[model samples]
Target: MTKAAAVLDYRAQARRRLPPFLFEYLDGGSYAEVTLRRNVAVLEQLALRQRVLTDVSAIDLTTTLFGAAQSLPVMLAPIGLAGMNARRGEVQAIRAANAAGIPFCLSTVSVCPLAEVAAAATAPFWFQLYMIRDRGLVRALLDEARQLGCSALVFTVDMPVPGARYRDYRSGLAGASGLGGTLRRFGQAMTHPEWALDVGVRGRPHHLGNVAPALGDKTGLEDFLGWMRTNFDSSVTWRDLDFIRSHWQGPLIIKGILDPADAREAARTGADGIVVSNHGGRQLDGVPATADALPAIVDAVGDALTVLADGGVRSGLDVVKLMALGAKGVLLGRAWAYALAANGEAGVAHVLRLIEAEMRVAMALCGRTRIADIDRSMLVSTAFQRQDSL
Candidate 1:
């Protein structure tokens, strides 16, 4: 109502507010980005039929996942280095997600440690595990999440190798090469003065707190960078899920799944849920879009497991589209990240409100009074329908 009017409007504003390096990191996809574009394009193409005069007054947006009830059917996708976007960044995001009555997944690479974020968050949040090569360290981190009362451990399994984001290369922001890398990033920070004054000057020291203790007493950005390269376990396999299961005793979500076979495997491996994601189309350039892959994954596992989808979910209509295709819940990645970069906690809260409002309106237009009332009949495949017409 405040004239930002739509979720995409906030995205545009966020692009202007954030530095190019940070913005590109959040917005860009894998090489060529075909799947990235497809994710959104496919959702946009899904046309829903509106039914008139159908008692849409008592619209109910609430839904539950893994036994916990949500105010809406959306969740905040985990994004690393959120602290770089706002002061005590992850905490701000957690506060916003709590206010919205949704779960906030804490990334393994978060700038603030698990304990501090847990202390600030009023409700239980999910913890995302990266499966670091240091098995002992991974165990320690799991213990930390357990002690902090995390509700679930979301294991990200897609990035066996890091995706090549050309934007990072163009910006030269990896902090890889010596003092030159340092100076370049410094200039990037200087370009965004407000971000610098707020997140940079007043923010908590930007270290990966969970793993910092394992790296010993060396407590600067350089040491943190070195620790990251040494720790991330690129060789992780399905068997590694066993190691994770042994340590955590709550609902387990295996993220970054695309193939139906992998989805079934996730269920066999005891995952309570599987996220149909291509790492938001950031991991594999040629992988199928989450929307395209979701139905198959859901069909493969059926009622055996919970199905969640992420990547290119920009609107409430998109949420409805995924649900009709067979997703119980959807995760918002770059959308909310843009909101966080735009105005911290308040900006993210605004986005939650905006998306919730859109969902309510979209549901009413589709003749659905509640989220559960939406079904596959509301959607028609363009290809199948056109073939029938022919």
Candidate 2:
């Protein structure tokens, strides 16, 4: 793990450690992955303005998110099937996030249930919800999150239906059935003996822990996929948000707001925050990159809501870039997922440390001493003006 020097290094290690199916599920985006590539490419194009002589001696990265203090302007984004990446992967990631003084958002379909993760964690974490067709199940899940003392509720609205990720089909990850598909998946798993021994063998609770009762008896990957196909409510609209608001009295964050109009609507819903995301480019292809979509969303609702962005945020400078564009903070998905898959909890901690270090260097170079001071001034006019105006 010490040899895993960077986030990309952890990604490489995860590729080696996990089976092709699980690795592709984590790494690949939907369809042609045009939006996926655009997310990172657009962020990379944004040049930072460096300042030579400025008093950046005491850099402060501390930020207050939804009234709670965070060591950095980052949180671990909710990722489904995190446990498949490593043994007790969600619990490990939550613990790592707690130790780092950041928030960890548990997915509705997380392998570890909210109570189990709450028991394992040192502090309260956030819970992410997916609107399913079953209202009873949704209410139960929200109650469970409240009972577990979750600090916030992140309602993900982008996934009316799962994206058509071609890699999942190619890698035999999309609940492949029958003799040939099963054999191919088995062969891929057999190739990664380490993952088989650790996650497959030792990590016994492989199914979705949160919705186990609703799913009842059907615990295999195929069953889970079948359940998702039928359960996700495509008819879910903004009216459904009133139901969520009526049930949960905590800080509500609307994730997957790619449009300024949607951002305004999210603000109107009384959401405390809105994550400017394209579901990490996994939901809608050919859409604007999250980086491209962020400035407009922020401009629409920055004053009314705590605007956050996620998608292709692989480095600390990327974090700073989103912040400069009026995002109060950022959420990390693949970076932490890759780290967790590579070296379990410690790998997550290492990734956080690296990100904090990178952020500090970037802040100093940009002549910003505090996280709040990092605004459009830190960005080159060519990038900031061009993108923000769009």
Instruction: Give the number of the best model, judged by TM-score.
Output: 2
Instruction: TM-score for candidate 2, please give it.
Output: 0.96
Candidate 2's error at 80, in angstroms?
0.8
Clashing pairs in model 1?
none
Residue 21 lDDT (model 2): 88
The 10-residue segment of model 2 with minimum total lDDT is 381-390
For each candidate, give its TM-score against the true structure.
Answer: 0.93, 0.96
Worst 10 residues of 1 by lDDT: 381-390
Point out where model 2 deviates above 4 Å: 1-5, 178-180, 383-390
Which numbered prediction scores highest in lDDT against the true structure?
2
lDDT of 2 by residue, 1-390 (tens): 221248889999999999998899899999999898888888878889999888989999999999999999999999999999989899999999999999999999999888889999998899999998999999999998998899999999999999998998888877587667668877988899999999988998888999898789888776787799899999999999999998899999999998899989988878899888998879888999888888788877758989988998889989999999888989999999999999999999999998998999999998999987989888886745476532
